[model samples]
Target: MTGAPAMTDSLLAVWHAYRLPILVAVSIFFVTLRVYTQSQSRPKTAASSSVPVSPRGQSPEKSQKLDAPAEKPIAPQNPTTKEIFKPAPKSVKPASGPKRVQGKKKPAKTIGGRRPSNEDNDNGPPVSFIQPIVFFASLTTTTERYANAFFPPQLHDISYIDFDDFFTTVPPSSSPDTRYVYCILIPTYNIDTVLSTFLGHLDETHNDFRIDTAPLANLAGYSVFGFGDKEEWPTEEQGFCSQAKEVDRWMAKLTGRKRVYPLGMGDVKSDAENALKDWTEGLLDIFGDILEYGGLGEGVRGSGDAMESDEEDVEDEDESQSGKKKSSTMVDLEDIKMNGDSAAPLPVDFTTVGKAVTVTETAKEMVPKTSPTYTALTKQGYSIVGSHSGVKICRWTKSALRGRGSCYKYSFYGIKSHLCMEATPSLSCSNKCIFCWRHGTNPVGTTWRWKVDEPELIFNGVKEGHYKKIKMLRGVPGVRAERFAEAMRIRHCALSLVGEPIFYPHINRFLEMLHNERISSFLVCNAQHPDQLEALYRVTQLYVSIDASNRESLRKIDRPLHRDFWERFQRCMDILREKRSYQRTVFRLTLVNGFNVDDEVQGYANLVEKALPGLVEIKGVTFCGTSTSAGAGLTMKNVPFYEEVAAFCVALNAELERRGLHYGIAAEHAHSCCILIASDRFKVNGKWHTRIDYQRFFELLEREKADGTPFIPEDYMMETEEWAYFGKGGFNPDDERWFRKNAKPRPTHLIPAEAQAQVDAHVQAQDS
Candidate 1:
């Protein structure tokens, strides 16, 4: 206690000496504390706002780093876009524009490993429209032309653009409401091209583990079209349009099966222009669907799998995992047999297969189920057989079934139209004939590089397909039970459908199969394939389509694809000269009014003198006023009148006689605007015998096959019907008259005089 008092007294003395200074320091300390407390208690003012405000999921430090006024993105000319995810350092900054060049500032929810589609993203601003980006890679400029023909806003020449812009991630949206869609037009090369480089990038993007597998799933949809040299690589197995197929598959995976339309392919040398146009029109229709309904149309989505595109080297997880694929619309029964399935399917389905079979999955078909050509042919009422062959119900057969009348064939050759099957083993032709009903819709090529279907497969498939179509016609208004029963037997195979039948590699075998089945073969060819014509098998009758009388006229009318098309045609004439002794060669002339009908008689006679065909069939051109014909300058006036056709036939006959050719007008089918001239071999006892005894033809074919014995067409000759003789109308005795729909009672010789005169003058000038 005494020590404490002593210390306190010393302290008191010291405090007294420093009392003034101590009191001042104590006051300053309390004042500073009060100021700090007051500042802390009060709300922040503008001056105290130096601390960073954190984003929802970010730390304050990171938020502060982001707080720096973002260096306005230095967009270069043609900026590479990856605006959805910040995958690279370059993407860390926002995209440069308010046009949604950058995605929304906030993150999007990932569902099933990808951003949800516009349909699933109701929580965000709705997608208002679909923005299409056409991507193409061309080697020889053919594919580039097709790309330009596509809907506008294309990035043609993928070589000029950065692949990372598209393949790396989902594309940046133009606006929050604008969804992206890819329309790709690619060409395939046997050798590597920039297209191959693009494919490599696409494959890398799909397989990269760092990115989501379906990173592009946010896209509305995608489709692809391809161009290839059909002459060099006719099928996808040999690399025709192969790179496009690869892109399609990769995009399917990347977009989570958002394929808007099926893959389409065209031949660079033949029909790429028309085929690409058709494909674009179809995509536009689908785009309308996406904009209005906000999705790929029903059942159209999720169809871009391995099986839909004739894909090779792919395993379908959906079918493999499930061990069974249920398809209510699969119509290719061969698929079951090809896959060794014990169960049989319904006999004839109107729908095509939804997925390809195991065998077809490993190679490209001439016409894939998903191809636009297949769709168009089917729409035009063709029953596709196997991959290449097709069978269609002929209007003449319909007429016969209705007891209206048989076709011109029945009048000229004495074969009942009801018992004939109009079909072709190959649907690919070498020409786009202006008068062809299937010219604009069918596939064309200059070679036979596609997969070769077996003769048995084609034979059996075509028969069934033909019979099925005939059965479907039973429901029509026509009623003739007796004729319908005859139609079921398919006594004759008329190989005169949309394409050159001889183009099929196994054409001879197909003919042998037909002959073995007692079905007579009547084959027609486009004369552009002389080698095939030389190797053709014996048929009930053989016909060469003489579309134009001269080279210039042929080029304009037929549009042959061969570089030496005229030479090939003349080669066919020589081959016919060699074939006429044994085969019943016929020259079938299709007289186009303004294209081939004026002053072509001399030219036709020259070809006749060279080939010396056993018979010359002259017929007027017939088109149903379709857009395809319209595009080729055909109109109602282009169809020649029956009288004009007869006059031309008479003129041609007179020219042949002047050349000392022993041909005489034998038969006419006035109702159908057809006439026939036969060599004197068929004229006996001053009577014409142009018709063939089909039974005798089959017998002779079988005999020749069995004993190595050969027979001439004359061996199976039969007398022509009295009503089918030259001055007669040639309408069948048991049938009623059938006029064209909406045809006036007057004659149909309404060809435009000016067009004919123009062609005549041009031809005369060319000759001079």
Candidate 2:
């Protein structure tokens, strides 16, 4: 059975291989037939659903025909290859009928009354980018008469605009609506006749342009022409010429237009009428051309051209009468004369008659309606007019004035003057310090509302203001006429006067006015307004009133505007560091008896290391002004013993040396005021040298003018403590007892034994 089964298996295996091939072929045929049958029987399904169409709108057959081309297979497009043939989109034809209306049109939006667009930004009105020009006219008593003649109030009012206003007003208005032409007219000449005639012409042509003819004041947007005989000029008249030349130079510097033409009858050789015609023609021709080119307006060109041309025609008449003429046209002179009705006497109330009084009641009685105090206070809406120029004037009481008595002080420039003026006229502070000398009633506004008074008035008022009180101190020796004159000129403004003058918006302008007038300023600040301080280009001496041991103490003493007062103070310290290159900055530390005295040595040393000021004044607090409260609280004495203060200073000096700093005691005056100087540049030969240049120093001082800082005259020398007080004391050279009583013996430990021996030997040799 096994053999039979084996043979059957072999046969089955062979048969299975052959049958498998046949079975595969039959199955493939049946599957192919079934697929073919299914494909033939089944209806074709679209790749996507067909969209529905309306039968009423179009016939089904037409729609089918229209869609038949879409049913055909579309060939894939290759963007890289160009198409051989492409069908264009079918254009839709509108029905032959009128179009339907949709909506109403909207109005366009506007910006500032003009259409809004990027073009609006391009054509927007221009902003004024011009910096105001400052013209400083040096006016003295000798020049005042000429000024009064040249610029009469009725003829022209130039006093209303300041130097800055003049500079800013030079460029004419761009707006077409404004008709006025602002012009500054400065006439510089030796002949009164020529000036008189010009004034006449100005009055006749007043409708053409607004004329500002104030002497020493600037006119804006106006052409300035000078008038001079060129033959007869005064010695003081040279200054006027120089000033005119300066103005011309400034104009040239600004506009890059150097050539200037003069208009006067003096230059022409014809009758006054003929000269006037020529002058008027030339003016009209030039101005008419300018106006045609849109360079000037009819307001500036009108009768100004005719009047100016008329002067040229009359030049010959001026030359004919040159030698014999006492003055110009009699009619012109008469035009300025006050009319009989117009010449009504100035009211007695308007006259500046008496001297300022000490007592408030007395002062009120003598005060003129024209007084600065009266005008300013009235404008400020304060009916309470007192003796002071401002409320702070009360601080300059008889006692306060007497306590801080006058002394013969010399400027670095060798100009001798008494330290008379006590308080600054403007009193608005940026820093509300605990130790300020200003009274509570002082005006705290940040700008000067009233016009600045003439220096002469300020000087006279001070003298009349403090007459008897100053005379009482005549007992003090070494007082001289020169000193008294200097005292009268004592408009010395202490920067720390009452408030922070730096905060005044017009501080720079005010200082510029003072500087031009040769007024010295000493600006002192508590280093609160760093912006104002940094803006300072000059000052006699920049004083940083440091009254603290640290940032905490600074905040406590100086209630500053910023929360980061300490940081600002440090920035001020850094600024002072730069001053070493051009300024003589003084870092003043008001040493209270018990408050900051203990930590002063280290604190001052740190400041010295940072700032490296020209002088470091370490002084005891004077129990004056608002300091009385702090003084009483701290039990501070006004006059601390000089020896004791000297010792403390000496110790501080030694400590400074150890830290690589060299210092010397500069002065020990009334209140133990010891000025310590960094001895890096100071030598023993009496020659004072500094890293900064003198010109730079002057420039720096000039920059500080607005701060109301009194300048240490260019000739004043900083006195050493020995020369200032000790050497001039009662301790006579002949009296050994007196010398021993006053002078503090040097500490032996401070000098090595060998060094002492050498000094002793040297002294012995010198004696021999």
Candidate 3:
């Protein structure tokens, strides 16, 4: 028994020493056994096994290896014959069935470890034949703008799906291949969040069929292009939004190489057209030969004349007349050759582009009103007055010409609608206000970025643009010939067209040119640049569009690009107050229904008291089209009604009274949903003097220039009698009696009695 214990102890020591190595060997043996078992038990699906490779594409040895138990790979019966490429059959799935996705496989069974017989697939190669291309646009406008830019129907059958409906229409089971690439167009703004949401949905559905089996990685196969305003994506480092940069980086990482092209947003036809060309070029790079003729065809073999023949055939068919529908059926070479050269090819015309086959064209039909250049501006209903200048016939101008109504400018400042020329010397602005009717694509700049056209050129251009516009209405159904002729005369120039006129470098000279032409100038400034306001000379009336009453409100409403814009605006107001005694100043408030219309009484009063504006025009914001910026989402409900505008005016007037200010509500124009509050200084002997005395003002300017004396605004001021708001003496062009009774002679009938003698002398001297 003692000997047995000693033996056991020795055995235990040996066991301990070998235990580690024994455990390692056992683990290895078990792993190998499990792997072998798995290899035997795994099912041989068609994708991984059973499909035999053709000897024509692979060596016999390789083919044998692929289908180890099958017979020798079949060789062509005719060694000298070349494989003829055949067109795929037309996609025939019913509307309710799963779509024919690119790279998708047709379910087929193996015949004794060999691929389906050649006769089974009509002697075609066992490859998926359909290629589907889809576009996921971030905005309706984006899709509309770029729909025809890439994948013109002549070359590709592209489909568009709305952002909301895309996932539902295209299931995760849909496959993609080298022959089929998809596109996802997303706005740079908030793209990170959008992609995350998209990927989360894919993961929730357990979609692992896509390329690289990762959501973002799948997008690597797509050719991406982005277009937006530089300001809209204003990050100095990337020259685009930070989110856009992240998307670019993600694409680069996923694709491992390809770069995204950035096309700066421009309000011109060429911008969209050029963006499309760029996208086509990028696609060409990605797809290589697949984009060329015969690339997508199967078994396309041979060289020289054979390939040329196919190209010639395609070209001949493409030569069909514009708008002609071409058949998708493949034309057989023998059939085409049999037709002979005597059969003239259909006349080829590529000018007429077809509309998108599947999507609604409503978005496409809405052309953006704003543009970047004179020519494009003209197409958008503006008259390119001159270099960097344009004119457009206002709705009020049309109304007055038809004897239907007049603009608020007419009622408030006695500006004859027919005689006023709505012109601007600059088409760019410093602010991108949400309520602006101008397209977001319009150019934005804090300073001049282009060559300045001469003042004379601008003047002539304005005249020509205005004349052309007026001529078109000469024989209009409702237009009065007399009024139309008067409109052609162009007595007044409202430099408040589409942009900040003060930004025009030659603005001062432009005003002088207008005055010299005996045309009164009414210049409008956005008050973002104080220096521009300080240098201003003479104008019949000057308007500062005060979009917001407070600094925070200003930033939200105006969306000014300048960091110190509020400071500059305040300085501009102070300058206006300084020039109050020298020039007529007006503060224009564009009240939005949901913005800047609440708790602004004191703010408005503070500005009024500081600037002492001759008049305050409180008008409601007009919501039109759609907003690209989510923050600027506005609807018809966001447009305040006339009563709301009046209520706001009443509140402002009450605040002014509380502060003992002299401004009071002077008039209301219900049609425009606007109210005018005027300074008591605009009244003479308790009578409102709203109508401008153009003649006296012009005479005074001439006298000041001839005598080399500084002109004071009060020197030529005239007394006024208040007109009825809605009765006999009210300002309504429709009511001939009131208009006729209230209408004063053009220019200077109200000159002070004391200045009559001087005015007569000056006129006599001028005639001599």
Candidate 4:
């Protein structure tokens, strides 16, 4: 025991001296062994095992010896090419740039070569085939007016491609190396418009599962600028430039997130100019970048999460730069090519009321499939045919089909109202008439610049539309099957539905098309275009609307667009006077009370004498309650009563007698508040020869066309029915008589003393 204690004491003394050094050595040895084992177990990535090289990309063997390690370095698998050029993350903006986006130091993409990116796309090889195309759509000419003032001549020159050119299917680049950039200028409309059609097309283009998700990936990029009415829409959330935002989203998806700039929105009434300018500057920057980089630049530069905004969309590279990013700007006025000339882009052949007009080489659609006007008209029981013509079913046609009374024409001119198809060859006019009921939906142009639908096209289309509309009424309660079948034949055509028929360039052909099918045409003119009136072809009956008696009153009633409207009006009267001999010319007077009726007896008498028309068809104004008519100060009070119309016709007849004109009251259709005054030549055997012989009229027309056979208005005149004479109600006994429901009583003081007895009889008949 004594000896063990001594040995332990010696061991303890040595342990104390070397304990610290011994512990340090043990820790170091364990750490080195653990580290070496962990290193051997770790996964070897390409980046980790990649050969280290110098800054100049030269192998390290040239400078220093690379001693081989104990274990062979894991050979890093080669990355596929797709992984090298994979699409960047969504958050990435352009990583590269022109470094010359100011358009000053950098050449445009189309003009010269650009710097190469990491790889060569189809548009690369030190040069780019970037084509920036501009597109626009206009309705009220506001968009066109702005585009004319805003876009550059060269850009406008290559711009104005039809929406169908690319909206449905992306057009392939001219070459495999080429790429396109669409710069769209758009307008916002609440109503269904062509822009709506375009948006729908975009929607379909992307949503269609049959097509590739990014079918337009070949496109270099796209941008949009929108025009909106701030007074109405106020903000994008409320629909201001909503279409443009939608376009941006779809285009981004279509082009594989290839948004060139940002979405621009401009308030037409407010900050459009400044907004468009700012947007244009940024767009110019992108153009410069495209020229230099041959793309919108890969990774990301000046990009953000694609988003919407109240006024505009702003983009950024990342969340850190969100606040610093520029807001999306307006469109149109500033995105013109920098080729120097700043001519207007021709999206269509239309001009604003006061802008300089440049006729396009091709005639464009006046009422395109996307126009809001088309929607309005279609909703108003009208079927739009071709580009401009429209066919509608008149209430008289419906009434006649139900065995109710026909229109006044049937009582006086012997037309079966149900067989009369109402159609117009043109849906444009030169007047905004106060009494017109069109609701301002029709286009008003001083000239005809729209596409001319072929006469046969209009003819076939209108007939089909009319027949189709008529067929829809087959299940109605009171439709007579025989009348409906007869209606399909279209015996008579009233070319007076909502537009100026003569505005059509091929009016004669349209009329001939009618005549060829044995359909009689009753065409009415607004009496504004003297040239068209003079060149008018033979019609069964041609009526000139004598809206007013004098120049000032005519202006008040017609609201004509031409500066020399009065001169044109007077010229139409002279032309009518010449046409009265061969053409069945009639002066159709619309007496609007408080505007053109009071104290205008002598003035109308002067017009009648000036034209010496075959007949004077005077009717009270029909109230078409619409905002446009209300804007012109028209109201229900402006519509004259039947008694007032008759008294006015009486006074007019007396005035004609005083002027030594051979005209007298021949017939009356009090239901429509209308009366016909015939010339002495039609007063055969003390009876009115006012009605037309339909077959004879057609034969005369065909003879005239075939051999230049001359004919007169009296050649086919037939005797008027006895019930259509003066003082008769002009109701067709074969058809039932009906009155409007809840109609109000009218004053009788406006009636002439002699007509009071007849008015009392009519009142008694109405009471019964």
Candidate 5:
């Protein structure tokens, strides 16, 4: 009985241990089942309540709209805890409140105004005179309305006050009582203070004078004048002054009244006293007998008899004033005087400017001097010296057609001095092309020798020579007196006046010296002197005369001196590529018909691609001077028609685009010449049109000396006047016949008769 009891107790202990493990297992299973049922059934509950179920793969966070009725089933309640855990079936509530989709959200509201269209932005500002005046900050709507009323079109002939030129000081009682009304309009920074001071002065005035002051808008038939320094006026004040809405509203208020005349004191550069004196005189001229001791309402002291006497006095005063005004109008003579003080007599023995200058010696020594005959003429007084180098200088004289067009005739200076030197300073070049306008001389040597004359001596000699030339031309007929005076003023230097300056060994140093003297140098080179070109100092402009298209054609047309000239030409182009720091490298292509016209476009494009010059001047080859060798046939016949030339430029632009280059024609002389710009930067309407900044052209030149590569893109090297010349290529050729029929032979009126004749002959030949 004791053994049985012990076994039973052991069995009971084992049963108790296993009972706890089994209970735990059962609790875990029920919990797992409850979680699984809740997850699956929650979505069913949502579906039964008319909520769209999310797709199987979609996250619950992403709410999607119900496109079609979903076929989800309602979850059954758990059987074990039906009463405790079961959800009561949802009862359909009566339609109440606002109906809303389960997950859809309302869109946000747009603030401010709707977006503006492109056209609205493009039409930015209105086009009106008042608008521009406001834009310049010269007048505000506050003042503009007064100006319009005072200067109304209906009162055009009526005398009005010119406050800008009037009221020098308080008038004396003895002064003639002319009917003139002096209206002084002042725009003071301290308006209130100035007005108070003016009122005090008026209050202290005698019975002979009267004064009145009114707000700008109410001041009808009154003159207006602005007084404020541009620097003094802050940007905010200027903006307020230029408000168009304010101006228009003011004008509307003064609809019937005479508008106030507006003027500014800043326009004239004179002391306040002088400006006031001038303004008073102008008022006297406008009003004759109406001026009185007091205001306009006061009767004249002197009656009709006084009018006659006053008229005589007025006429005399008017004459004196006119003479003084004319004298004042003359340009300041001191400004015209040569700025340089280094003047010296010529070394030659010949007296009188004309006899002292001679080109015969220079012509003979051309190979040594590497200077043209024109330079010698300038030294002899046949031309005026404006700018100079050791071997060359530019001379200018007034045109016989006084001030009608470009009235300066240019010539070369210093050729005679270099020629007289015995060291053989001249370097002769070959290639007497038909386009050349200089005297054709035989070629001599390939190199230069001797130390050239100093630049100072050349300048002085040129200047003296120029004065002498004008004195000689003074007696000549058809010359205006003004032109003769203008001939004495030398302004510009053209280094490439006649021949290739590159041949001179001292050419580089000469250019450097010219630059130092503030003389702009324009050097033209014939590709023959590639070596010399390589060693050249980049001047204001470096022009290469591209006269032919292909090597064979160039040989035939250019008649080069060296057999390897073509190779040297290409080499020169390559050198130009290396000297990209030079901002004004220009490839001047002389266009000729029946020669290389057909291929010139392509040839120019290729060369431009290689050289990447800053500009390209495609001009007609002038048939003047020695070029008369070709005469009427080659000279006249080889000129391209303006239309054809324009077309060719268009095609060239197209080619430039194909090569990934950006180019535009800068200038056009119609049938004569067209300039193309290749720089990445250019200007239009006072704004930059390209990536290149022309303002930085000089700056880049300074910076680029250390690194010769062009900071600008290579492709933007050839810009042509395609739009102006061809007009997108659809216009009728005869639409504008003026250029072909009546256009001037050349755009430059300063070109000599011989040059003009050559250009005319070329154009006529092309037309024929």
Candidate 6:
């Protein structure tokens, strides 16, 4: 027993002496094994492949000490789980070459890996360690060229893959020790589309892919950028910078990262040096940062400059064109012909100029910067129209297109509703008439307080909007294809849509555009701007909406915004009376039941005598319902019955007789509860002169430019008859004469008599 204890003591002493050295050796072995296992598990991607970078050019490993705490690891997946990522086809070779310059073409490759005879296979060394797989979408050839110039291959390891092949082009499978940095470039033209598409990939369907994006939440590890032309943006204020701001917001919401850079480019070649160069330099810096650091760098807020412009230059141009030196009512023939050679300036008169407001460059700023209200209006069957104007598909217009019925204008004056386009040059109105059916929520202004769009732009936009409306109606249940086709080429423009058309500072210019387009204009003014009336050129039909008879009723019904409302109304009437020559002037009285239809017939007659309109249309107020604020205040009681309207017309005719005026009830539209009174002046040789000779009117305008010679009212007057009215024997659709009188050819098309005849026949057939 003593011998055994002595042996144990000796072994214990030996162990105690070498304990420190033994522990050190075992620790070294475990450290070496752990590092080796980690290296083996690392991803085998190309050396120059994309990786997250830091703001300062430092490697991720070196910057690791500076960064925040690392994200927690995702739970391990089952080894038996099937891999979803498939390998790319062998036929598809990765792009490899020296960084190519923009506009340089690569040699064509032969089918199935065979080099074309024209090219030399002397394929030089690969310029980059990683052959990039770029995916591009919705980019035009020119855009692609520009993008290539910005991201040269020498600088970037990018592969330009077709946008369609992106999702289908399977990515490399993820491993426990490795993650990929995906960079996405989107076009600003289709921002909504591209963003939605990218987000769609992260839906529940991708849950089984075992791709964890937790690391990207803190660091902008996955890169995404947008680029587009600055000019293509909707507005200057909301264009480049605004869109970029939106991108930033959306990125933060979707990816939980606030890293997004939008590179603004030019719409034309001139912008290359300014916008394009700056973006290119910025891109290079981004690449350098990414290469140095292992994460996306700090987001770029500004690229030194944006699509900046000189406001003074634009104002100077506007001043030069509008000519502030001249009288507000003066129409310069030379300036009128500036946009188009065929147009002539309308006659100018300063005799009865009321206190008017001119829309200068300063006032342009007051104009609604955004049209959110108009955007909502579009959803209510309105057209996708105008830069600053609006057009709506009227019930009458819809009915005519479907051969169901026509508008009151069609029955009153031989106007064809299918050929008419209802629009407004201005969305703001001076008066908020209580009986008005338009949306009460529309913008209102006392004077011209907004930017006036160019006539050419307005005309083109309105016509395009009309075309879109007709196109949409093509498949509608009641709309006839043939009628819809006729509606595409507008013949007449009714300026009675919503706001006052004359509210636009360029009213005369807009009228000239319409005349030049061979589209007859029917301008309706609320008599608030007499100066505009004096400045206006000739139109097919000019209706003054005499909402009330005298000063008190006018204030009550019309609700004029101007403090000198009575003076303006009287002055506008005087100008209308003077403008009877070369234009069809009419006084439109909306007969309200408990409002103006009382003992005010004499008052209306006296005012009518003073104006001496060619025709006086006394129509019952239509209860278009009260959705608008002004409309909400009005009730159905204000609407007059057909019998009540007829009595008022009769009383007004009697009053006209008392004043020795030759005005008489020529026609009536019972459906609209409207009565048309034709003055004896229009009844030359016992025939009604209601229809307009649009061709002769334009000829006179062109001829009378030099001496400012005014054409007489009889110059373009056409014969009308009592039978032409609704319920009259003259209202036959089969009557070719009536059709010819109403269905004039638009400037856009050579509308043959056969087309009008076909439309009439269709309407008659439907009625039968």
For model 1, the superposed segments whose C-alpha errors exceed 4 Å read 1-363, 739-743, 747-768
State the lDDT of candidate 4 residue by residue for 594-671, as single tens digits: 778878998999888898999999999988775334434567767777877887887788788888889988888988
Q: Residue 698, candidate 2: how far off, in angstroms?
A: 7.1
Q: Pairing residues by index, what is the TM-score of model 2?
A: 0.38
**Clash count per candidate:** 0, 46, 5, 11, 42, 15
Stretches of candidate 5 off by over 4 Å are 1-364, 367-401, 407-427, 442-444, 449-456, 470-489, 625-628, 631-633, 683-768
Q: Which is better, 1 or 4, measured by TM-score?
A: 4
| Candidate 3 structure quality by residue, lDDT tens digits, 1-768 | 799999999999999888544643454344335433433433211111111111112112222343223332222221110100111112211122112232322233445664443234321242221132434333324543454333322111111111212231232212222122334343443321223333333332222233232222222133444555554435436445343334443443332222323322322222534554445444433232232221222222211111223443354367675567654334356655444554633322121112112222231211122322333456568866434567788878877888877777766777778898888887777776767766443445554535467888888888887888888887777888778877878889888888788887778888888999889988889998788789988788889999988986786577665556788889999999988887888999998755688788789889998889888998998766553322244556567655556667766877897899887766656667776888887766766677778888898889878997676555555543244241112357453422346766544443334334543343354236
Window of ten residues with lowest summed lDDT in model 4: 96-105
Tell me the spans in candidate 6 whose CA falls farther than 4 Å from its real position.
1-372, 384-387, 627-632, 705-710, 725-768
Judged by TM-score, which candidate is best?
Answer: 4
Greater lDDT among 3 and 5 belongs to 3
lDDT of 5 by residue, 229-329 (tens): 34444443563222222222222222111122223243212233333334333332222111111111111211111121344337547878886632232
**Model 1, residue 182: what's the lDDT?**
75
Over 4 Å off in model 2, which ranges?
A: 1-420, 430-432, 439-482, 491-493, 625-640, 670-674, 684-722, 725-768
Question: What TM-score does prediction 6 earn?
Answer: 0.49
Ranking by TM-score: 4, 1, 3, 6, 5, 2
Count steric clashes of candidate 1: 0
Taken over the whole model, the C-alpha lDDT of each candidate is 0.68, 0.38, 0.54, 0.68, 0.38, 0.53
For candidate 2, the lDDT comes to: 0.38
Per-residue error (Å), model 5, residue 702: 10
TM-score of each: 0.55, 0.38, 0.53, 0.56, 0.38, 0.49
